[model samples]
Target: MSDFLSSTLLFLLQASRMTILVSSAGLLIGFFIAVAIVGACLSHIPWLRRIGNLYTFVFRGIPLLVQLMLAYFFLPAAGIHVPAWVAAVVAISLCEGAYIGEILRGGFLGIPRGQIEACQMLGLPRLDVLFRVEIPQALKLTAPSLINEAILLIKASSLVSVVGVTEITRTAQNIASSTFRPLEAYAAAGLMYLVICGALALAGHYAERRLART
Candidate 1:
């Protein structure tokens, strides 16, 4: 490769870390938030369920790009200043949490009620039944969907560039514009994403198989 190509590769390689960081942070945070939402949706209280439903409605209904723009642009006007990376991660976590809520809610609800009752009859406390029985089964059911969500968020991290976060996709755009090498820069970016996502897919498959055995 020429010096320019070599530098471009290095630039993208370095920038790829930011992409991974943002996506991983969002996925982890979103998972915790989704658990809370799912618990709310599953709660016996009517008002809590409504709050969970409304959260899902608002986040899932909005276009992701618009959400990104709003996070980066609107928050500052309201005096909620944050760094570009913080803005991207927060936007992604909130939006992805909505979808994850549905995934986990479906999993929790799909469990047989008889099983819950059986656990209850075993003298397990409510919290014990939830932690030891219900949540575990729900995790088994939702693992695949959660894995897919992680992959989606990784790709979506490209949009973080709009907020001035220097991730892989944004680096590609910068390199292409500066060197007039869109093909090379974009091709490299695509390959990087493919590799990252492919690894996640493999990991997900492994997890599914492991869960099957247990």
Candidate 2:
């Protein structure tokens, strides 16, 4: 309730948008890439399956912080420089893409082979079968895991500050340093994250209920 806490809240509220933006952007990128990854994993082609497995292993095997550091620090040496914002988003996207691919793969595999076989026998085009039947069902089955990953990404975005993209956590750090009130600044930051993630969870629950009714 102090004036300092009030101003700190204002600063974090403004910067929190960056957290949402980065997380949303990352997730969008991940979704698109994951489609490809899932395809690669499911491919009858041996090379594609191996490549997809390798990519997923590498990304999921490494910690995200390491990925962000490599994107920002090491890529320049390889002459693939990007802005800090781009680096942060790319790191999150690639990392989350790996996990999302696995989640979707599970969904795909969970679907009985009879369904795919039936679609094939029904004269449906391969693409049509995939888009209309398999992918849709896979997504529905894995919706909860997808939502959970999204929430995790929002919190993980706090690490983007290390690459110089000022998000809510970075804003809190700044206020904590300047005001010498680490407890208040960090507490506010945690509450903001909790609110955002809680809202997402509630929304996901509602979606699942609606899906069940259908």
Best by TM-score: 2
lDDT of each: 0.89, 0.90
For model 2, which pairs clash?
none
lDDT of 2 at 11: 92
lDDT of 2 by residue, 1-214 (tens): 6888788888988998889999999999998888889999899999999999999999999999999998888777989878898888888899988999999999999898999999888999988988898888888899899889989998889999998998999999988898888999999999999999999999988887776676
Question: Which regions of candidate 2 are displaced past 4 Å?
Answer: 78-81
Candidate 1 local lDDT, 22-92, one digit each (tens): 99898889888888888888889999999998999999999887888998887789899989898888899
Backbone N/Cα/C clashes per model: 0, 0
Quote model 1's TM-score. Answer: 0.93
Worst-scoring 10-residue span by lDDT in model 2: 205-214
TM-score, candidate 2, is: 0.94
